[model samples]
Target: MVSIEMIVAARARLRGHARRTPLLSSPFLDEIAGRRLFIKAECLQHTGSFKFRGGWSAVSALEPEVRARGVIAFSSGNHAQGVALAARLHGVPSVIIMPDDAPKLKISNTRALGAEVVLYDRAKEDRDAIGARLSEERRLTLIKPFDEPQVIAGQGTTGLEIAEQAEEEGVSSAEVLAPCGGGGLTSGIALALEARTPGFRVRPCEPEGFDDTTRSLASGRIERNATLSGSICDAIITPQPGNITFPILKRLAGPGIVVTDEEALRAMALAFTRLKIVVEPGGAVALAAALFHGEQLQEDAAIVVTSGGNVDDEMFARALALRG
Candidate 1:
């Protein structure tokens, strides 16, 4: 289990590095849910996602000699960009392995950050195998997206900030919801909330098709989806939850909630129109949960962490049309 002291230390370490993203009250959401809604806009975070916080924290904690050897990662999008940018900042070479079907915009942006890109077909090739081979051959440090303790500690910073902001606004006992991919962000958020606000519930919201966390929690063990079917929320399509994250989530997060792709699209459009923020479908899952499944959450202020804002232009426009 992650400790509160570690979360506090992470916040201190990431103070100047990660943006202190705004925690704003959304009247539109409040009206719909009949309760106050506070959004932690991590979509505005550096590299357009909260993954940067963990990437930077992990790299910054490395020994000087290990840093010299450089780093490698496998990600669909946001984590790739996070590792790429964070490696560059630390004067280390970085390489990212991504599924061939990952967003072109994200791939291009990661390359723009000077990271070498390796593409693999999700159907025919295993990205983790490729990453392992590359790590062994190149003597590179592997940064598993959500499995490492350091990464979880790094991600905990976002929750720490939310807790502080919630307290300042006099909102107690918020039901904090975050989208679950491999569970890094949700687990980290739960750690911070558990430590700071005793009674607050932390929930992991996921797309219905790719809800491994929900199943894992229900079965009281790790579960795997045999295959990942694409969703509008591409970012949370991990075939299985991480070994490290599942146990933490089982201990801390409330029953995982699954929302549909249509619900996610509606939440994305709502964020764009009402908040003037363009959030990726994956990032909007928390809000979707609030909108579509409010009855499941405790009737108090709910803090929805919008995790990223890296939607492609075409996808963004299409989501708007679908929602309309």
Candidate 2:
């Protein structure tokens, strides 16, 4: 289990490495949500996603000799780039296994960041098998996206920032919503808030078809999505809640919220026009839930973590078209 102590240590490791992203608000967005909405603009995070924190935590925590050997990760896009960049900064070799259909920008960016990129089919290929084989062959460390304790601790640092920022903003209580994939960020934030601000609860938000976390939380068990590749919000789509993250999420999180792809895209449009922040569809789901699913919430204010802004140009243009 991830504790506040571990999170503090991770923060220590990240002192100069991670950016303490801001908590932003707009009266216009507040009006739409019928509550004060604070946006934790992690879209502005390094590699344009919060994954960098986890990547850095995992890479930096490794034994120096082991780390020098290299690291490997499997991601759709954001995690790929996050791990790629973190490894580069640490002067370690990284091999990233990404789905072939991930955003072109993300694939290109990971390669550009100085990692070996390997592509695989999402539906047929087992990324775990491939990663295991690669790790064995190359003597590389595997940074499991959401399941590693150090990675969770790193992501929990985001919660620590939210707690401080909310205090600074005079927000004693608010629901913190984060886009959920395998539940790393949501569970991490939940654990952090559990210690820092009991009044602040974390909720996992997901795209409609890929609402496995939402369903799993309601049922008190892990739930699997029927398919993984159809959503426009690809970043948060996962086969199921992670084994390690589910227990934390089930223990600490509030009822999950589900949003549609259209809502995500509209939220993206709103972020661009109103907040002047570029948000990818997956990153916008939490804001989508905060704005469009208010009846499901009880808080007077909501803090939304826009997790990433790594959308492809064509998809971003589609979101921009929804601005009206």
Candidate 3:
């Protein structure tokens, strides 16, 4: 399990490396939601996602000799770029295993960040087996996307920041919503808020079809998504929540929030138009919940953590076309 102490230490390591993205607000958004709305623009973080914090935390926590041997991670896109760039910054080699159908921008960005990119068929090949083979062959450290303690601890730093930011914004209480995949970010934030701000609660947000985390929370056990590759919110789509992360979420997180793919796109469009922040569909899920699912929320103020902004130009154009 991830502890607040671990999160604090991760923040110390990330002080110079990771960005402290701002907490932003728009009156227009507040009016639409009929409550105060704040956006934690993590999309502006390094590698255009919050995954960089976890990447740096895990890589930096490794022993010098071990880290020098390099690192490996399997991600659809966001985590791949994060680990790739973190490895590059540490002067270590990185091997990224990605789905062949992952966004072109993410694949190219990972390569440009100086990692060896290996493509696999998401529908047929097993990414874990491939990662295992390559890690053994190259003596590379495998960074599990969400299950690792260091990664979860690193992600918790965002919650710490939110706590402080909320205090600064005079928000004594609010529901903090974050896009959920394997529950790393959601659980990490939950742990942080569990200690830092008892009044605040963490909520996991997801697209309608890939609501495994949401269902898992309600059922008190892990649940798997029927299909993983069907949503435009692919960044937050996972087979199920992580063993380490699910337990944390079950203990500390509030009920999960589900939004439609179209709702996510509309949130992205609103973010672009109102805040001028480009958000990917998966990244917009939390904001979508805050905006469109107000009836499900229980606070006068809502804080949304926009997870990533790594969408392709064409996909971004499609989001903007919604204009909702």
Best by lDDT: 3
State the lDDT of candidate 3 residue by residue for 1-324, as single tens digits. Answer: 578999999999999899999999999999999999999999999999999999999999999999999999999999998899999999999999999999999999999999999999998999999999999999999998899999999999999999999999999999999999999899889989999998889999999989999999999999999997889997998999999999999998969999999999999999998999989999999999999999999999999999999998988888878763
Q: Per-residue lDDT of 1-324 in model 1, one digit per residue for the tens?
A: 567787777777777788999987668878987788999999999999999998988888789899889999999999999989999988999999998889999999999998999999989997888999999999899988998877898899998888899999998778999999999999998888888886778899998878889999999988887678567788888878888888888888869889998888888888887888879999999999988899989757889999999999998887799855
127-246 per-residue lDDT for model 2 (tens digits) = 999999999999999999999999999999999999999999999999999999999899889989999999898999999989999999999999899988789998888899999999
For residue 43, give model 3's deviation from the true position in Å. Answer: 0.2
CA RMSD per model (angstroms): 1.2, 0.8, 0.8
- The weakest ten consecutive residues by lDDT in model 3 span 315-324
Instruction: Rank the candidate models, highest lDDT first.
Output: 3, 2, 1
**Which pairs of residues collide in model 2?**
none
Error of 1 at 241 (Å): 1.7
lDDT of 3 at 189: 92
Candidate 3: stretches off by over 4 Å:
none
User: What TM value does model 2 have?
Assistant: 0.99
Report how far off residue 130 is in candidate 2 (Å): 0.9
Overall local distance difference test of candidate 2: 0.94
TM-scores of all predicted structures: 0.97, 0.99, 0.99
Please report, in order, the local distance difference test score of every candidate based on alpha carbons: 0.88, 0.94, 0.94
